[model samples]
Target: MLTKQDVHVLRTLLQEYAHAASLPVNQEKQRLWIKLNHLHMERPMVLIDQIPWNEMDVDGSLRCLVADTYWRQVEDNLRCTLYKFRHMPADMVLNPYVCLPRPIHNSGWGIEPVSSRHIELEMGSTAPSREFVNQIQSLDDVERIKIPQLTLDEKREAQIIQEADEIFSGIIDYRLTGLCMHLGIWDSIAMWMGVENCYFALMDEPEMIHALLEKMTEGLIDMIGQMNRQKLFDIHSHVCHCSQTFLEDMPKENDLPLSGNAWAFGLAQLFTSVSPAITDEFEVQYMKRVFPYFGAIYYGCCDRLDDRMHVIEKLPKIRKLSCSPWSEREHFAQVMPRYCVMSNKPNPAFLASGKLDEQLIRDDIRRTIDAAKAHNRNLELILKDISTVNHNPSCLWRWQEIAMEEVQR
Candidate 1:
């Protein structure tokens, strides 16, 4: 259903993206990051804030694409890169191509869908609150949970792929990419049983909690097995949790790798307030079931892992750990040196105040740099979870400038 205008818009963006990809600097930065991830000598890297786009002053013309899902996706990717080019300091590789198969729908899960009541936030509130309608009220509900089955529609997939190929035949390469998986066990269960219930279950119904975790883990393992059998897993590089880490042992093109050769990300932001012992029992133990399937692990998110270093330290495949704003800077600076890349997440709240506080931002960056240097930890400064820029796009650009200057200093 693409009109002449739609095609024109797409071509313009693709050409611009292609030109950006062809830059030699982008390739050089990519090589540098690869070296850094491998523990080779390099300067501390910085990924300009992973802005929350929902809170930004997005351009109106691009917003018009929302009416068409396919075009909207293309627009979003192009818009993201365009913004990065204009402001962010992260490495920008020029190849604008991405391979994704037509969506494969899944059904037949043993557990019934959990319901929740979404509550709107009051004016000025940052995030909306939700009340979980507990679906697993007792032990019997645990037994009802079953493994899920996945099915693919080959004919539909072929059409979708063909359409994508036709749309960008000469503009950009659009090929099929493999399946990517993220295992969020505790968070998934908390949604069904409620976060409070999960905490209480650890004390009152320990056995039941164990049973549920076992079932969920088994279900996830089965899903991975199914994906592998279908040759759905792809060789894709992601940076969110792993911080420029790549899979060294990826399978050859058209071949598939077992979970042990693939990259996996796991985190439990929901368990941040729990004791390490409780976290170990409920979160880490269950995660172990799936972690063995991946070649490398990227752990942690917004949670402060300063106190639970001992627990995560045992994860053999961990290559990067998110040292969020709430994390103890000195503790991570010490422990992460011996473990993995410190994915330092500076507070984005400094920008959320509607004006750029250059001095405060520089001071914060200096403290992190000093701490990481003290212990000789490989650090990747990642500014993320940005809720707002108060409609000032220049705030991000200035922040990136300040970050690069501070890091170079």
Candidate 2:
């Protein structure tokens, strides 16, 4: 239980953050981003790394149901503060709201859950990777996989919103909205069958692989239909993980936002090792089945899409493409400028080196900026997939300093 004093402290901190977010400077910067996203004009924008909360020194004393609510608000405020102080081009908004009917109960593809164990190499690591035991062994197992029916618990959802409102009514606004589904086809299949097994299945059992992909695609389409039927699609106009670009077409107050008004993301990180042809056949073709359901698409993650640019070009709604660290920067500068927003993902490994190198950081940012300028591309730098900062928060602060310096130049 949170003491009255605890609530007072939290409410005070939240109000201060909300006030900062409401400033005109932040609002204009966000509008600039929206314009750049819609291809109305070209400009550079940056989203500082989405740092993991466990990486920071946050107080963990709050407990129970209140603790859950308290921590969520606290973390957002803290990160927003960090971004402002570092001069990173991240947007700040008045309220921190989340959509409901998250669709957690339904595991669309009916595959046996894989067993996994987390192995942490060091203390304060960003997040641990799991060692998985693959559950699907043969083609027959694919038949057993069935798509589960989705059901929304309205009463429980209302109770959650009520409790949150009571706690944060005057401090900050609480909105019950909808969110887009981030459904990855290749990643799910690789999770069921081992990565190696998935590769062999492509050649040894091409027919079987196609059948499994078809089934998974069907399940995802059905899940999307369910979400639409339940009125769970909400407009995400703020800075979100769904896309690096901002939404140009947001629904009006009286209108219900559909998936077409929001950004949808699709990735095939596991398909990195596969040939472009195989990736196009197995991943891109299946993804196309679901991509049209959204207003716009954000494609790629950690994977390099250099060879498969042609395949990606086929997606009519793709508005942003991830230019990962592994991608050829020069090549992408030439290809991506004419197409979509170049969502450049800088390598986060520098943070784990235990020492901050200002020169190295500057040079890295300079190279990316130079390449983007030469091609006239709309760029957004996103620093993600960080595992550690070696307990030095200053490294991220320095990185933002260097990145903004380069952007201004």
Candidate 3:
């Protein structure tokens, strides 16, 4: 089922990544190559000789070009990795497009203008489940989209984030970073109505919550479909991005687990900044309606995950899951076991904490290994954003020890 052109594209991509892996021009590129190599070694069967990878242009001029370039390389390598896992020898990778919240990335949440009346009315709408209906509706009624009125700082804040985001457009995978897009209506609702009000509305006014999710999810699905057609959905490679924990707490009316549509179900669980209670609610109710649209589910993102792990055990279509810094390592090792592959990330504290010694970091990895062993031996270590590491490359070596030690055991 492989074609010469497809295979050639992949080989070129792999070679580029291989080159980038050794040559680190900047911090972002270095991280990208290192991560690619880690994946290649951890899942050699899926990445090394099995799947096809291709290189492409890294868009965005304002951000770190090196990081963007390196990610492009990794994206190509991951294509091959995904192909081997899916048993599709030459198919291009089609992942979901995730728009996450702001808080997950340590970027504080800000208020976006929205209409309570319009949102309330949309909640009771009887429209078909077509995607982007809200956008269409919003466009049709621009007046409804008007903000109640924001303070000067709110406007400036929103603008600042927008400008800064453009700079790091492709560098930070915000979709996976925070779970969902920051500019969407529900996001506005959360910031404007306050999480407490919006949450209570989920139960007190079911129609309102239903309308909000339907509208928001529709926009997301449309975006994903467009990206899929354009072959740009690989940006947010992970399905659940940052929403796995939030899905657990979603109201029974909202929890939507992935349905088995090989193409559509490939990605689910993209909500972010969501709590355990909300994650369950969405998993039990809402996601049920939407899950059939993806091929697989990638769960977990930046979340307060202590309460969410128990719920992950029940998701039926999940093929891969991310292990957040906050999640209990042993819990994942005990729960999903072989059903899912775990991406283990050492907390920022470990790398950012000025106390950078092998013993301290080694203890942390030792604990992680001891915990993951209870489930299965599979694991991948991810050394994410370490501003401090920028000054001290030696700290990275400790990470190598941690990973290698775990493998040796």
Error of 2 at 387 (Å): 0.9
lDDT (tens digit, per residue) of candidate 2 on 95-146: 2433232323465556654647667866545577665566665678778878
Give each model a TM-score: 0.89, 0.87, 0.47
Q: How far is candidate 1 from the true structure (C-alpha RMSD, Å)?
A: 2.9
Q: Find the candidate with the highest lDDT and give its number.
A: 1
Q: Worst ten-residue run, lDDT, model 1?
A: 242-251
Q: Which candidate tops TM-score?
A: 1
Better of 1 and 3 by TM-score: 1
The whole-model lDDT of each prediction reads 0.72, 0.68, 0.40
> How far off is residue 251 in model 3, in Å?
34
- Candidate 3 segments exceeding 4 Å error: 1-207, 224-232, 235-277, 304-306, 313-316, 385-393
Cα displacement (angstroms), candidate 2, residue 252, comes to: 4.2
Lowest lDDT sum, 10 consecutive residues, model 3, at: 44-53
Q: Rank the candidates by TM-score, best first.
A: 1, 2, 3
lDDT of 3 by residue, 309-378 (tens): 6655565555445666766777656665365556666675665443476787777777876676555445
